[model samples]
Target: MRAGSFGQLTQDKENTTQVTFHYVEGNTETFTIPIPASEFQEEVLQLLNQPWLTFHLVDQTVFICTARLIKVEIKPAIPELQGQGIFSNSMRVSTMQRAAAGRLPMNT
Candidate 1:
């Protein structure tokens, strides 16, 4: 697995977010981005409007073609926080809760 500076998916990593890119050719690549929940959402929206996205790694930079990208998955890097946002702090809120608040669909 390719672990980035944002850290890996562990129970203790609540500050990190896991972003997975799915391509049209049935290939997928996952990256960990260390950003807050709101910031991460903004970044994703910006990426969707761009033609290409870049990932700066330790020794190299990876370029992604947005045209061939089929899907993008965003979730907390921590397994225990699966139902919560990136930085939920103390008040834990699940996707269902957010959906009820009209933030997202109730059945996504």
Candidate 2:
């Protein structure tokens, strides 16, 4: 599981209570996803054309991406009642390392 802030809230009626959060799975990579402002959903579907990419939301705004199915945990969000305005949130991501299987390397 990971933790972060829901950066900003959108004005759209359907998105008013949603916030976007930025997260990184490993050391230097980053992933971002938008979710409901106050609730955490079990599953999240992300639109990606690539077949090797997958996305998962840990909390309302924090998300993670991986190519394999792994265990994930979610943490509680720290409500910021003082700042009800819209803003962007940043988060940190954690991932488990796995051994690579024998496969032909792809050529660029």
Q: Identify the leading candidate in terms of TM-score.
A: 1
Residue lDDT tens for model 2, 71-104: 3222333244233352337554433222232244
What lDDT, from 0 to 1, does candidate 2 have?
0.35
Please report, as a residue range, the 10-residue window in candidate 1 with the lowest summed lDDT: 77-86
Candidate 2, which segments miss by more than 4 Å at Cα? 1-26, 37-40, 44-51, 54-108
TM-score of each candidate structure, all chains considered together: 0.56, 0.20
10 residues in a row with least lDDT, candidate 2? 42-51
Over 4 Å off, model 1: 1-12, 77-108
lDDT of each: 0.72, 0.35
- Which candidate number would show the highest lDDT if scored against the true structure? 1
Report clash pairs, candidate 1.
Answer: none
| Separate clash counts for every candidate | 0, 5
